[model samples]
Target: MKNARYLPLLLCLCWGGQAFADTPLDLSHPAAPTVHVEINNVKGKVTIIAWDRNEVHVGGLLGDGAAPLSIEGSENNLSIKVQAQGHNGWFNWSGDKAMSDTELNINVPRAASLKVNVVSAPLSVDGIDGGDIAVNSVSGRVRIDARTPMLEAVTVSGNVAFSGHAKQAKLQTVSGDILAPSLGQNADLQTVSGHIQASGGPWAQLNLSTVSGDVQLTGELAPSGTMSIDSMSGDVQLQFPASLSSSVHASTFSGDLRSDFGTPKQPEHGPGSTLDTVAGNGNGKISVETFSGDLRIRKQD
Candidate 1:
C-alpha cells in the first residue's frame, strides 16, 4: 500500500519535468492611453496589436535557452527587451551559438506610441489609432495596419506593406518592395533598388526617390498638392483622375516619355526630352525627372 501511494508522486514529478522544458510567458503592466512603448528584439517574429484597455500585455513562447522577456520602466514609458540567456552582456548574444530565439505577441493601448526595433525578424502591427509609430528592421518584412498621425518605417532588404491612413509617413528601404494601398496627406518614400507601389489619398505633398527601382503612384491630389518623383534608371508612372487639375514638368535624359495631357518635346541638339504643360485648371503641381527610364502619366478611367 505504501508503494502504491508513491506512484502518484512519481507521475507528478515526471509531468513537472516535461512542463519545465517549454518556457511560457504572461506579463502585464498598467499603462496610459498615450504611453510610450519600445520593444527591441533580435531574430524572432514580433506581433503587436492594439486593444482598448489601458494596459500592456506580453505573452509568448521563448525558445530553448532563451532568456525571459524583460519589461522595465514606469507606466508612462516602458521598454521590453528579449535577451538570450548565457550571454556575455545584457541583451547581447553575439557569437553565442547556444542563444535562443523569441517569439513575442504583445498588446498595447490603442493610442500608445510604439517604437519597435528588430534584426532579421518579421514584425507586424495592427489596429493602432492616433499615435506615433516607428518600426526599424533589417532583412525582415514589416506589415502595419494602423491609422495614426505619424508613421515611419525603415528596412534593409525586406518588403514593407501598409494598409491604413496617416497624416504624415516616411518609409525607406533598400532592395525591398514597398506597397501601401491607403496612405494619407503627406508621404516621403525613398528606396534604392526597390520598387514602390502606392495608392491613396488626396495628398498635400508627396515625394518619391529611387535608384534603379520603379515607382508607381495612383491617387488623388489635394487642391494645391505637390507631387515629385526622381529616379535614376527606373520607370516612373503616375495615374490621376480624369478631372484632375495639375501642372506637369517632366524631363528625361535618354528615356521614353509618354503623357496623356501634353506632347513630348525633344531638344534638337541634345539627346534629351522635356514636357512642360498644364492639365485641366493646373491647380496642382507634378514633376518627374528620370535618367534612362520610361515615364508614363495616365488619366484614370
Candidate 2:
C-alpha cells in the first residue's frame, strides 16, 4: 500500500523531466493594433509573420535547459525572451550549451513595431506594414520583407536580404553579402568584404559603400534624388533608367571609368580618370568614387 502511494509521485516526476526536455509552447496575448514587440533568442531560428488579428501568438519547441519563456508587458507593448541558465542576454550567451536550438514561430499584428536580436540564429520576418522594424544577429542570416516607415537589419558574416519598401531603410553586414531587390526610398547599405546588389527603387536618397566588395545598382532615381556610391578595390556597375536626369560625377584612382552618358577624361599628366557630365534636366545628382575599382555606368535600353 505504501509503494502504491509513491507510484503517483514517481510518475509526476518522470513527466516533469520529459516536459523540460521537450517543451511544447503555444502562448497568446492580446495586443493593440500597432503594438510593439521585442524578442530575443540565442542559437535558434525565429520566424515572425504578420496577421490581421489583434493578438500575438508564440509557438514552437523550446530546447532543453532554456529558462521558461519570459513574456512581459500589456496590450500596448510586449517583450519575449528565451534564455539558457546563467545567460544574461546577448552579451552573456556563452554560459550554457544545453539549449542547442529553440525554434520560435511568432505571429504579431500587421502594423506592430518589432525589434529582434539574436546570436548564431537565423531570423525571418514578413508582411509587416507601417511600423518600425529592427533586427540584429551575429553569424546568422537575416531576411525581412516588410513595408514600414523605418527599417534596419544588421549581421556579421551572414547574408542579409531585404525585399520590401520602407520610407527609410538601412542594412549593414561584415564579410557577408547584401541583396536588396526591392529597396526603399531613402536607404544606406554598407559592407566590409561583401558584395552589395540593389534594385527596384526610384530612391530619393541612396548610399552604398564597401571596403573590398563589388557593388551593383540597377534602378531609377527620383526627379531630384541623390545617390552616392564608394568602393575600394571592388568593381561597380550602375544601370539607370532610359529617361535619367542627373549630374553624374565619377573618379577613379588607378581604375577605369566607362559610361554611356559621357566619355571618361584622362588627365594629361596623371594615372587617374574622371567623368563629369549631365543627363536630362540634371535635377538629381550621382557620384561614384573608387580607389582601385572600375566603374561602369549605362542607361537601360
- For every model shown, what is its TM-score relative to the native structure? 0.89, 0.91
Winner by lDDT: 2
Q: lDDT tens digits, residues 1-301, model 1?
A: 7799899899999997875565777999999999999998777689999999989999887665566666788889999877666563434546323545678899999999999998777999999998899999889899999999999999999999998798899999999899998889999999999999998879999999999999899998899899989999999998999888889999999889998889989987978789999988999998999999889988898
Clashes of each: 0, 0
- Give the Å error, residue 120, model 2: 0.9
Q: Candidate 1, clashing residue pairs?
A: none
Give the Å shift of residue 77 in candidate 2: 0.9
- Cα error, candidate 2, residue 194 (Å): 1.0
Q: Which runs in model 2 stand beyond 4 Å of their true positions?
A: 1-20
